[model samples]
Target: MQKLFKSSHNAAGALLVALGLCQATPVIASETWHWHGFVAQGLMRSADSNFVNNDGAISAELTEFGLNSTWKLSNTVRLAGQLMYLDGGNRFQQGGRIDYLFLNWTAINDMDWQLDLYAGRYKNNHWLYSATRDVAITRPLIVLPQSVYFDAFRDIAVGSDGLAVTSTHNLNFGELELNWSLGATPIPKEQSQRVISTFINGKTEQDFVHQFSVFLRPAQSKSQWGISLLDSDFNYRRVANDIFADGDFTVQRVMANWRYSEQDWELSSEVFQERVSVYGFYAPGTERTQFGWGAYLLGSYNLSAQSTLYLSHDHFFANKDDKRGYLLPQQSGGLIPAYFGYQRDTALGLSHNIQPNLRLKMEYHWNTGTGRLGPNVVPDTVVNRSRHHELWAVQLMYWF
Candidate 1:
């Protein structure tokens, strides 16, 4: 029965991919309106139990479909939005949801200088790949580096509702760009499970979550360097008075990125430090702070105009001070193991452009440690005890 289920799921995924390819339409324009979209399907399996749904079996829950459009109301102002559907197992909510909706204004545009403003739900372009990562073809791997681009925070981290500004300067040497956003968005129940109710069964509701991000990129020759800061405030409320208490969460993150691309070779690296503060959550009048850090280096080479190979090493620690999870057992009275405090991942990926509108990627990941595992998917810590795991995935994406 299990084998039959897996085969059926893979077949459905393949059918979806084929339908997407056959039906994909190019960016259509009618005078001032322009539109485009993409669809992707992925089949994944883990050698050992992991956090994503039904870990030991081949699963096709990794799916993405989106439609985006823009209306150029004027030369300087435009309306833009997207409707997206994603089913990433425990990573995201099932079914469809509006990804982003916004109006863009070109406040200033001149030779070597540009300024833009946006109001509404806008994509988070601060991270190296946050803005386009939802589209499989635009991403470097089926799953992004888990340390910086965690799956649990996908919806909240992808975009926010409010206001943003962007500016660019074309310098004699190269270019410089600066962007910042401030807004609020609701946090889904699944996202709150990771932090709010670690061991208990509960649902979480957030009236609103405030988020802010700022990014600066300076480019010279064939290399570009970026610095970004992301911060958020969460006001959480437990539903039905579950074993969890209502509280506030504040998260601050700082990251640095550098990339060099020339001809058929590209090298990219990013390092980040994060600080999380919890108030009145664990106990009344109690405040705790945790510091974590992670980094990744990726190198890619184009074998031909239609194929590419990539290799990356990603490492992260829940607590930088305790890289080995020394105090976890003591703190939890041996209920939780120390290996749950960090994760080390190494990945090899290959992608081929079968056609201008079709692309495929095959990738493998070797992971050590389970610190970054999502509790919502693999709620039982015992299932993650192996500390060493492997994942193999293939994704097909079609877009115009």
Candidate 2:
């Protein structure tokens, strides 16, 4: 992994230079093509031994760079894509990776109705920040709400290789946007280990993962509200024999989002409910079910054109039915602690625009419980456990 990290750093340098040149190059055709890119570096540290990543100490692992481009072939056709390199501790993949590549076609383009069809690896558009979360400058915090944006499946939930159709209707009041996507993507081994090992006590390899989503947003004035239905189906194969079983895992998620932005202040909130089901894993006649719920409330104020301040509160439950985790001790044979059932986080964030193309960001998080921490990175044992902790992060980003 260290060697891979070194190689990724070298590649990132070269890509940065190339992206800078591309951004500087003028567009030959006025309305045909455009290119832009960004580079961000950050430092994060937590005051605990829990596994946010590698001992949870101060680390210089937060680095990302990307190049995005669009080619407008005609009035109704365009090719849009992004190539990105990301390494953000254990929350995401550590080395170079292709983020998204897609083609978009507009079948109906008019003032009242618009339809778009996309194929290839398309970005997830349901969540409030899913579309642009990869770019550091666009996010309001170092980490988005973990309840909705669980880090264990960060890569898995970001994009899918399939098809999507988006439709927009212009109304007298505001507008409505509807999107539907379906596809499958492969899960990396490391990600599988991080998420699966805690629940299943054996070595597992992903067989196939399927994803589907439907989102609808209605907007009026300066406020927009949306509801999304998302589904993920995962199957695993046993590599080495152990106590855990090889079977199917399915997750169904329903999320509601609302945002209001006007004048100098913005308020946003999202609530999600996730249902998890497992089949043929523990026993032949066994069926297990659990439901998890989470929500976040965020408000931001623009002090000036170049500076902004924001605060957010986020909370999550591993099992809403057993919020206290008393049943968890019995369920896991007393190996896991009760506090693993829930987590609550409060954050204060501020961002300052140093220049038109450069920005600085700082944030602090006061967190309770480790219910959602990556298990592989942070073992579920008392020796490495801390129920309460604080995290501080600083980032600098530049884009052109």
Candidate 3:
């Protein structure tokens, strides 16, 4: 199945490239084609923590360069894709990747409603920022709230390789939008180790991820409300001499979000509860199920035409039943620390536009607990020993 998906993706990319080449002809050159790109570099530091680097030194690992293009094949069809190279230190895998490459088709269009279909690697639009997180200037903060946008799972959560559909309906009272996606992301060995454990010596595969979401905007109102649902499955295959056994995981999530905007200020929040079931992995026949929850509230104000300020609070717990993590150490036979069970953060950020196409951003975070850090399957006790830590970053971005 993975091989088939890869082949299809390659074919779609080739077709898009061919179409782009054909558009070079004067007859077709008139067709709509747009290109955009960006370059961003930043400095980050994590004090009393290994979130950025184990040595706890200021790092210049934050780097991003992306190029994207959209070509209109016809009035009802278009091809869009973005290629990016990123090195975010411990945040995610470092390398070049296709952020999204897909063919979008307008399936139905009318005065009151419209439907669109997508095939190939589609971008995730279920979350408020999921669709634009790849662009540095589009994000509100240098580092987003980890409770929901955990950087370790960036690639897998950004999108999937398969199909998606979106529809918008105009009603007497408001406008409603619905979205659904079914797909899977190929996991590399390095990413698997980051998500599971560095000790893992096996291949991790995402079987599928099914998601649905709905959004509503009432007439004459500046507020938007939304709800999203997600279900995913994963499997791990161990090789010879591996310490852990083959494993299977099932994850389900329900999320609710709201956003309100005024001329100068904006507020948004999202809360979610998730259930995770694990089988084997640690040892043969080992099984467990845990419920986790996360939430974040953010507010931003436009200080001026070229400046903005942001504030937010974020929280996450590995087990809702043990928010304080008092039982975590006990459950792990004293090997895991209590701090591994939860994480809470308060952040402040500011962004100034140096020019229409250039921007500078800075942010500071006061964090408690280490639940959101990496090597989650097995806590990295040595580096993440502190329950309290701080993180700060400054970035400069340019785009055209």
Best by TM-score: 3
Q: Across residues 1-400, which tens digit of lDDT does each residue of candidate 2 receive?
A: 1111112324434543443322222433357777777888989887573445647679777787877767778888876666777777766767755555567999998889999998766788878888877777788887888888776777777776677888888876567788888766556666777776554544443333333334434444677788888776676655465555567777888888898888999999999898988876665555788999999999999999999998999999888998886886797788777778888999999999999888999999888877877752224565236778788888898887
Give all candidates' CA lDDT scores: 0.74, 0.73, 0.88
The residue ranges of model 2 lying beyond 4 angstroms of the native Cα positions read 1-30, 49-51, 198-220, 282-286, 376-379, 382-384
Ranking by lDDT: 3, 1, 2
lDDT of 1 at 147: 90
Instruction: Superpose all Cα atoms of candidate 1 onto the true structure and report the RMSD in Å to 1 decimal.
Output: 7.8
Residue 4 in candidate 1 has what lDDT? 18
Give the alpha carbon lDDT tens digit for every residue of 225-314 in model 3.
Answer: 999999998999999999999999999999999999999999999999999999999888999999999999999999999999999999
Quote model 3's TM-score.
Answer: 0.95
lDDT of 1 by residue, 1-400 (tens): 1111111224333433332221236466777777778889888887565556645778898788887777779999987766678887756668766566678999999998999998877778787888877667778888888898888777777777777888888876567788887776655565666534455455443333333334434444677788888777666555575555666677888898888888999988889998988776555666878899999998899999999999999999988999998888897788778888888999999999999889999999999987777762223475676889888889899887
Tell me which residue pairs clash in candidate 1. Answer: none
Query: After superposing candidate 3, which stretches have Cα over 4 Å from the reference?
Result: 1-30
Q: Candidate 2: give the clashing pairs.
A: none
